[model samples]
Target: MKRLLLLALMLAPVPLAAQDMASAPGGTLRFLDKVTGRVQDLSLSRGQSVALGRLTVQLDECRFPRDNPAADAQAHVTVVDTTATRPMFTGWMLASSPALSAMDHPRYDIWVLSCDSGFVAPEVTEPEEDPDAPLEEINEG
Candidate 1:
């Protein structure tokens, strides 16, 4: 009877708590050329693809914790080798734990950096004063 009870408990499903995540418009990724020992960082938006050496990387989506955007960023990415018919890698890669779902390429290594929350401000440029136009004089009080 004790063995049966223990078996039942072991077979029971454990409840898991779900974390709240926010999807960002884009994310940054790092790539390394293993042969040359060169590393490069690539920033890509969702559905955008970039070519590096013989591989092309495409970011499908990026997600981060709602409370902390910098913590635990995960991105769905697909990597294709131009010379090959099949994709070399396609899956979600966690920024904190890259080995959890790392690409299996011998010549290259790729990993997620962070999700871009669209917080970067655009550059504001003031219009140049017309060279030929008359300037308005301000009256000093």
Candidate 2:
């Protein structure tokens, strides 16, 4: 039954990655969009509330490798705000990994703010008329 247990472990979902923020169950946090890797965190004035439209996210789940409990692999994260209606936007995100080496907490909700003059909302592109067109665009050419 060793094979059976191994199969069970392989099929199980990563439970740690599926947790939601508890303190503010439905609320969103505001902060600099450091998650997007474009805006600088220091530039964001703390304790300032700002309007928002889109959110970027990055998550890394912690896990251990077989035969090596000391060596663990942490989750990864990156979030983008395509619906950037406002030039800047930010919301709270959950922190998952504590005491890990990261710029921010694994599951802490931080505001993601983006500020750029050219960061205007783009018009939604329409699909082609071809009934048999591919599910996704293959070429913009």
Candidate 3:
């Protein structure tokens, strides 16, 4: 009787606890060209797509932990080969672990870098030129 009860409990489905994630406006992705041994970082917003070499990468969404945004980042991406009719990869890619859900491409590799949330550019101010300063004449050869 005890064995039967234990077996029933073990067979019962257990629900997983979902983590609280916050959505970001955009995120950064890294692309690697295996042939040329070149790597580049691409910044893209949600629902944006960019062409790199023969592949087109589309960012569906980017999410991070609400409690600690920098702890981890996960981005839903869809990678399509321009020469192919169907998409090569479409799934969530984690920033901390790229190998977990990596795109299986021969020439190129794509992975999530970080999620950008409420990012603002710093203001640029030009230096004020002195009116009293004499300008030096340039000699054109």
All candidates' lDDT scores?
Answer: 0.94, 0.35, 0.93
Q: lDDT-based ranking, best first?
A: 1, 3, 2
Q: Per-residue lDDT for 1-141 in model 3, tens only?
A: 999999999999999888899999999999999999999999999999999988999999999988777768999999999899999999999999999999998889999999997645579999999999999899999
Per-prediction TM-score to the true structure, in the order listed: 0.77, 0.19, 0.75
Q: How many clashes in each candidate?
A: 0, 23, 0
Compared to the true structure, candidate 2 yields what TM-score?
0.19
Best by lDDT: 1
Tens digits of per-residue lDDT for model 1, 42-111? 9999999999989999999999998776688999999999999999999999999999999999999999
Local accuracy of candidate 2 as per-residue lDDT tens digits, 38-117: 43242222232233235444322222233332232232233445554432212322233323323344323343222211
- Residue 127, candidate 3: C-alpha displacement in angstroms: 28
How far does residue 74 in candidate 3 sit from its true spot (Å)?
1.1
Evaluated at residue 93, the lDDT of candidate 1 is 100
How far off is model 3, as Cα RMSD? 11.4
Q: Which ten residues in a row have the lowest lDDT in candidate 1?
A: 114-123
Ranking by TM-score: 1, 3, 2
